[model samples]
Target: MKSELQVFQDYIRGRELRRTPERERILQEVFEIHGHFDVDGLYLQLRQKGVKVSKASIYRALPLFIDCGLVREVDFSEGHWHYEHIYGHSHHNHLRCLGCGDIREFENPALDHLEEQLAREYGYHIKGHHLQVEGYCPGCRQAGAFPAESNFLAKDSNDQ
Candidate 1:
């Protein structure tokens, strides 16, 4: 029942790394994000928030935070990894909007049960899994959002 920061301190202690204000600041900045975020996006966010934290520091702390179970890395098939802080929260899945890059979180006990059943039938131990469904969100569809083509293509069509 230790706090997330306490758990992180324990993790760093086991690794023989000294606790620093930089790691603590990075952890605080990360906890401020309520949704999925990428490394660069997080770095930029911290900078914009006047946190005085360096990108290298954030990048270095992310793996440790993940190992400490404070952040969970998620993949939405966008060629990069997104992370969510899962400490003090239950696990969930994602629904990503292909048109606008919006992401929604969801959870279902049925899906969890199905995963367990499938793993049991295959005689494999389930460590963890990630599910990301992609489609146009309601807002995108309402706005007629579509993936933009190349600038050349747009120019050619406009010249017609």
Candidate 2:
């Protein structure tokens, strides 16, 4: 298996695009992240780590990163792109905290069987799926707003 940087470098070379150290550094930073991240958050993280890459450079390299299968874009209708590593990870679902914009990854093998059954029933071949369950985290949920008896609907910030 080729290293992600090597794969990306080869892709750029094959496309006749020049490779730069800045882009490679951006890829290095991105590949290191094990959690979901957006362009703004990644830019700040790199800067805080004393890396000198600009936000524009990170944004530009993201497409190439996605193209080379090093990253994937996840959307939850948040009006921006969130990315995570896909090169060496298995399929997973997301639990997104709507209040803090936090994301947690989880996987259930049973989903594969369920997906297969659904595919067969629909007479379609399953390629892939991205599932995001959005809700307020415990910290974001207002105390006493949602009683234990009716906890299915937790009062989020907007309900206040």
Q: List the candidates' TM-scores in order.
A: 0.81, 0.75
Which clashing pairs does model 1 show? none
lDDT of 2: 0.84
- Which segments of model 1 are wrong by more than 4 Å? 142-160
State model 1's lDDT: 0.85
- Tens-digit lDDT track for model 1 on 1-160? 8778898999999999989988998888888888888989988887888878777888789999999899988888789888889999988888889888888889989888988998989998887778888777878867978665567744434368
Off by over 4 Å in 2: 138-160
Alpha-carbon deviation at 125 in model 2, angstroms: 3.8
